[model samples]
Target: MKGRFVTFEGIDGAGKSTHIGWYIERLRARGIDVVQTREPGGSALAEALRELLLAQRMPIETELLLMFAARRDHLERLIRPALAAGQWVICDRFTDSTYAYQGAGRGAPGERIAWLEAWVHGDLQPDRTYLFDLAPQLAAQRRAAVRTPDRFEREDTAFFERVRHGYQDRARADPSRFVVLDGEQAVSTLRVLLEEDIVTLCNT
Candidate 1:
């Protein structure tokens, strides 16, 4: 049997991590064979690379390359194996993050990113992706309150705004696979919306 792959993405402090847990709970309750994971740090090597990528001293280009490298490892090792066994793969972030942070935010060439994605993913794409939408300033404020900033979190507001818009552009281009949800709302409200969306997906 084929498996479903879903990914969640957003700028820092968009509540994706928090809500992903909620979605996992829902899936598990429904008896789905779910595998919850995150990008840049799923396998051991990838997790180690995550620390290096998120370190304060790394250059932006190096960070982008490391992110993709971690993703490549994740796909080949964990993601592909789990999906082949007919398990739902729920990832916290994926290639959309590269386009947002590297291409749009860091001014890398979109064509190059596209080529890399094509080479790595082939026909593999998320069956569904939920983008937690929020203003960059609001997200920054949330991040500041929660914990110390990572390398990307400490970036300037202008960069984050570009990332935000990048996510919007990707979602607009692929509405069939991407769902944009308001991140400013209460957690319960967002959960209800997500539940509705899941019901719609399951029925189709």
Candidate 2:
């Protein structure tokens, strides 16, 4: 049997990170062959690129190119192989983040992004993408109390708002592939909501 591909997405402070470990543990408890990973990393080369992406200021085009560069390596060298071996891949972020951060947040041309996506990865997408939706202002507040903001995290609220909408637009366009979750709920409640869909996905 083919393995499942699931990705988690949200704004920086939307609380999605709080539940990733729980999902991994719960999915493994259910006897699913689960694997946890993240992008713009998963492979060594991608990880290095991730550092550059998060640490430096670059043009939107440069950002887009670098993201895809890391992603190509991640998908080809890591994600695809894992799935081919029947390991369910749970990723922290995926291409959706590009559409949100670069395309929407940075004002990259949508057509260009679409073209690059097709050229770099043909018909490859997560089976289910969990989007934790929340207002960017609230997300920023949550993030402020945590570690220092990185380059992307340092963006203004307006930038994050666009990123948020970008995620929503993608979700709206592909309803079948997304599970939109409200992020205001308590961590435990969020996990319960996620586990139900996650287990159902594994069973199917």
**Strongest candidate by TM-score:** 2
Report clash pairs, candidate 1: none
Q: Compared with the true structure, what per-residue lDDT tens digits does model 1 show for residues 1-204? A: 577899999999999988998898888887778999998889888999988888757666777778888988999899999999989899999999999998899998888889889888977999999999999999999988889988889899899999999999999999999999999999999999999987876666
RMSD value for candidate 2 = 0.9
lDDT of each: 0.90, 0.91
Clashes of 1: 0
CA deviation > 4 Å runs, candidate 2: none
Q: Residue 38, candidate 1: how far off, in angstroms? A: 0.6
Model 1 root-mean-square deviation = 1.2
